[model samples]
Structures are given as structure tokens and as C-alpha cells.
Target: MTAPRTPILAGNWKMNHGPSQAARFFADFLPLVQPADDRSVVFFPPAVSFAAAREAVQGRPDVRLGVQNVHWEEGGAFTGELSVAMAADAGAELVLVGHSERRHVFGETVDETVRKVGAVLRGGLVPVLCVGETIEERRADRAEAVVVEQLRPVLASISAEQLPTLVIAYEPVWAIGTGVTATPADAAAMHAAVRRTLAEVYGAQAAEGVPVLYGGSVKPDNAAELMSQPGVDGVLVGGASLDPAGFAAIVAAAG
Candidate 1:
């Protein structure tokens, strides 16, 4: 039997907090959340605050720090782009690749996402690759197809050895930041599809080890119900994660 995937409650503080704010958040929130062996609490602070965030989580093995985005190239003349090595130097243990904003708003292509994923692994960091369908695609009954297409190239780029370290978040465009969450049933169905796709690309054993997380409009009030669904191993929180009390509650709900 496949072991149960560890529940990961990752907060994506996208363009929200700076170093001081990040430090304050960790100081206030860390004490509120007791350490857990079966769960992980990750903070994806803005690149600028990565160092502070990392420092805040120091000595706490349960809490990990990650960067929102990283450039695929190791070193180059790319202006204002952060390299994976730079993120690692800042104490980031994980990186977010192909986030919805990076894909839909910033126009990150699938190939770029694949390269970024590889770069993160090469830099010795795990990757939380985001994949999801837009409202239009869901309305047209292409949710599964869209997710499959978005994930295929990136998953293909990762070798079987790297599969165990990867995390996938499914955040429907409409639900993200809109206070609209997919029903627990809907989320479970999509998560199942995601796992099936992983199994198809790799194998059942490898796919079972991967944690599939839901990200759209996740909050403390609904976190427990969502997490209880089949195939949903965790959550990638957005606006709700900005508040220490709110995020801590969500993490508690995950238990």
C-alpha cells in the first residue's frame, strides 16, 4: 500500500509582505502552530523577503521557506529576474513554478515553466508546480483536458527520481481570489484526475507519493471539508494566508 502523502499547508504571500512584515508574521504565527510530524507548514514569501522569512523559520524543522518564482537560467544578463541559485542562497527550500498569475497574467509559457522546474531541482529545491483551468475552459467541460495539457510537458521534464519531491497545486482561475471555491466534490474529482495523469506519465507508485493540493479560495472555515476529500493532500492558500490568525487556523484545520 502507498503511504499517505503528508499534508502541506503553504501560504503564498504574493506581493504582499516585505522583510519586516514577514519577520513579524513568523514571530507571531510560529508560536500559535505547534509542530507536527505528519504535516508541513511552508511560507512562500516574496523574493525580497525570502531571507527574513527563512531566518524566522530557523530552528523550526516543521516550517519551510520558499520563493514565489525563479528564472530558469543559472546566471545571465536577465534584468530583474531571480535565479534558482539566488533563491537557494536566500534559504528557500522550495520554489513555485507556473503559478496562475505567472501563467495567465505574466504569460509564462509551458516550455518556460518546464525549464524553471528543472532549474529549481538543479538548485536543490523542491517545486510546487501550479496547474489549473480557467472559467471558460471549465464552462466548456475542458477542465481535465486543460489541466492535463498544462501538466504534461512539465511532468515529462521531471525524471522519476524527482517525482517524489514535487508538489502540484490545482487552483481554478475563477475561484482564485474571488472568494469562490470549488465544491469539495469538484476539487476531489480534479485532484483524482491529476493523480491519474501522474500515474499515466510515471507510474502508480510514484504518483501516489506526490501530494496534490487545492488552492482556490481556501480558508479556515472550509479547509477541513476540502482536505477531507479523496485525493486532496493539502492546500495552497492566498488572501486568507495573509493574516497570522487566519492562516494558523487553516493550518489547524488541516489536522
Candidate 2:
């Protein structure tokens, strides 16, 4: 049997928060959010403030530090880009690849994301790979297909042995930052599809242990209901995470 998946609540600070701001957030947030042994919490600060974020979470087992993005190449002339080694050196234990903004705004392709995933593994950091469909795709009745396509190449890059360490965040484009959240049933269905795809690529055992988190406008009010869904393992919080009390409430809800 597969081991039970550990629930993770990660805050993606995105473009917000500088070094001092990050430190302040930790000072206020550390006392507010207390994850249980079974739950894990991660903070993905902007690359610029990673060191401060790392220092903030120091000695806290439940809280982990992660980077927003990383370049696939180790080094050499990659202007304005952070490599996996740099991220790891900054005390990041995880990395977020294929975020929606990277794909939509920065033009990150599936192949590029695949390469980054490999680099993250080689760098000894867990990857929180983001996969989702846009509103247009969902309207066209191709949400699952789009997500599956996005996931295929990335999953193909990793071996079965690496499956258990991967975290997939399903953040539907339509729901992200729009104050609109997917119903628990809809989120569960997408998460289930993600697991099914993993099972097909790897084996059932490996797929069952992989945690699939729901993102996009996830807030304290809806956190419990979303997590209660069958395949909903955790959450990738956005705006709500920027606030200490709000995020803490969400964590409390998860526990």
C-alpha cells in the first residue's frame, strides 16, 4: 500500500515582499501558523529575498523555504536568471516550476519546464510543478486534456522512483486571482485526473502517494471544504497568504 500523503500549505509570495518585508512576515507569521506533525508549510519568496526568507524559517521543521523559479542550466551567461544550484545555496529546499505567470507572461514552454524539473531533482530540491488549464480551454471542454499535456513531458522527465517526492499544484487559470474558486467537486475531479495520469505514467502505488494541491484564490473560508475533497491533498495559497492572520486561519483549517 502507498503511504498516506502529507498535507502541504505553501505561500507563493510571487512578486511581492522584499528582504525586510519577508523577515517581518516570518516574525508575525511564525507565531500564528503552527502546522501539525502530519502537515507541512512552505514559503516561496521572490528570488531576491530568499536568504531572508530562509533565515526566517531557520530551525523550524514544519516550515520550509522555496524559490519561485530557477534556470535549468547550472551557470554561465544566463542573464537575470537563477540556477538550481543558486537556489539551493540560498537555502531553498523546494522550487516552483511552470507557474502560470511563467507560462503565460514569460512564455515558458512545456519543454523548458521539463528541463527545469530535471535540474531541480539533480540539485536535490523537491519541485512543486504547476499544471492547469485556461478559461478558454475549460470552456472548450478540454481542461483535462490541457492539464494532461502540460504534465506529460514533465512527468516523462522523472523516473518512477522520483514520483513520490513531486508535488503537483492544479491552479486553474480561470480561478487564479479572480476571487473565484473551484467548487470542491471540480477541484477534486481535476486532482483525481492528475493522479490518474501519474498512475498511467508511473505505477498506482507511486501515484497514490503524490500530493496534488489546489491553488487559485484559496482562502481560509474555503480551505477546509477544499481539503475535505477526496483527491485534494493541500493548497497553494496566493493573496490570502500575504496576510499573517488569514494564512494562519487557513493553516488552522487544514489541521
Q: Estimate each model's TM-score.
A: 0.98, 0.98
How far in Å is the alpha carbon of 245 misplaced in model 1?
Answer: 0.6
lDDT assessment of candidate 1: 0.93
- Per candidate, the number of residue pairs that clash is 0, 0
Q: What is candidate 2's lDDT per residue for 167-203, written digit by digit as tens?
A: 9999998999999999999999999999999999987
Candidate 1 on 1-255: residue-level lDDT in tens? 988889999999999989999999989998999988989999898888888888888889999888899999999999989999888887888999999999999999999999999999888899999999999999999999999999999988899998888999999988999999999999999999999999999989889999999999999999999999999999999999999999999999987
The positional error of residue 147 in candidate 1, measured at the CA in angstroms, is: 0.1
The residue pairs in collision within model 2 are: none
lDDT of 2 at 120: 94
- lDDT measured at residue 161 in model 2 versus the true structure, 0 to 100: 77
